[model samples]
Target: MSRPRVQFMRRPGRLMLSAVAAFAVVQLAGCGKQAAPDAETTATLIQPVARLDLKVAKAAPGSRSGEEIYQSVCVSCHGTGVLGAPKTGDAAAWAPRIAQGFDTLTQNAINGIRGMPPRGGGADLTDIEVQRAVAHLANTAGGNFTEPPVGQ
Candidate 1:
């Protein structure tokens, strides 16, 4: 199988890796130049590009992003590929996984997939909440997401 594209943001001109930070993942711009890593920031951030008529667009300050959700819940295993879970920031790892599609992924998280134990192991979080968390990671890892698809 062809190797899945992997994007990594290095120093000034470090080819930006569009993986876990799947921030720009779908586009994967294929840019050879990496933007200077933002200084003094603990993590790459997620800001609203635009929103639909849904209230999800109006999430409060400190309301987590998909990336944040991944970090909080999914990352522990995904970040390291523990228990056969895909590793974060690895497009190859995510490629086949994304092939499983969103609905299935969501259900897997809501219930529990093999190796993964429901919401990556958190049971108390709501389905919607876990959904956002899932999108964050999926998007970061490069999945065309639109839970709040525009123009609703």
Candidate 2:
């Protein structure tokens, strides 16, 4: 009679669980001289990291169209007017900024405004692409500016 040997990793679910446990232990262990909370702490600690990973993964790609860049990057802050950003298509909000003139607005967008990061947080966007996106947002908000063609 022969006995069967079971390898731990031969079971994918078990391997995954083991890996997660190991990760939780390593994460908790890094804290100095603190008592670790049991199983529930692992899930709580992992959730924020997972959310941040998804945010980084969703970062905008380079050389996209104005609308695409707006949808991917600008929408996060601009669409909802987060952090004092003017909401897209808000005529009243865009009024003062439009009065600043197109060049100044695009320059601010390119250089980072009070709450906005440079290039509307799409660090990979080309200068012209950013300009186009600025125009797109401005137009949607009732401005009549025209975006220059790419490369000039």
Candidate 3:
């Protein structure tokens, strides 16, 4: 049993041999300086992807319809009858205001009426855009109206 225990014990000679091999590897890593790559070598290491998107040309300046203006600017308030905007679709809500005639409605819209902001909050809109926007709102409420030009 004592002889078997001695045979099972690890040999220190093998441990020392492994330690020397590890030390030689670490010393070799510290012995050499790395060389820099030439321009061609560097370029070969990194390849760029091609840009494949085609550039789109500009579109012509077209007339802005009343519906376009309403959706862009007025829809925030008028779309859901917010702040007593007379709603875009409810005839009962729009009736009294509609009876006032298109010209009055257009003027009020251009100048800002009661709780409704001017040009439905788009001051940059032309007077014609205001009139056409009113027509669009009025038409949505079942009133017949011709769309005015987006001028002046």
Which lDDT tens digits does candidate 1 get at residues 1-152? 98765554224345444244576655576867978877645343554566567454434333555665676678789887889888776778777777888887789888897888876776656666666776667776787765532122
Which residues of candidate 1, in runs, are more than 4 Å off?
1-64, 147-152
The lDDT for every candidate, in the order shown, is: 0.68, 0.84, 0.79
- Look at candidate 1 and tell me the lDDT of residue 125: 64
Total backbone collisions for each predicted model? 6, 0, 0
Candidate 2, which segments miss by more than 4 Å at Cα? 1-62, 150-152
> Candidates 1 and 3: which is better by lDDT?
3
At residue 47, what lDDT does model 3 achieve? 62
Alpha-carbon deviation at 151 in model 1, angstroms? 16
lDDT of 2 by residue, 14-96 (tens): 98998899999999889798776777888777766434434445434444567877898799998888999999999999999
Best-fitting candidate, measured by lDDT? 2
44 in model 3: Cα distance from truth in Å?
18
Distance from true location, Cα of 72 in model 3, Å: 0.9
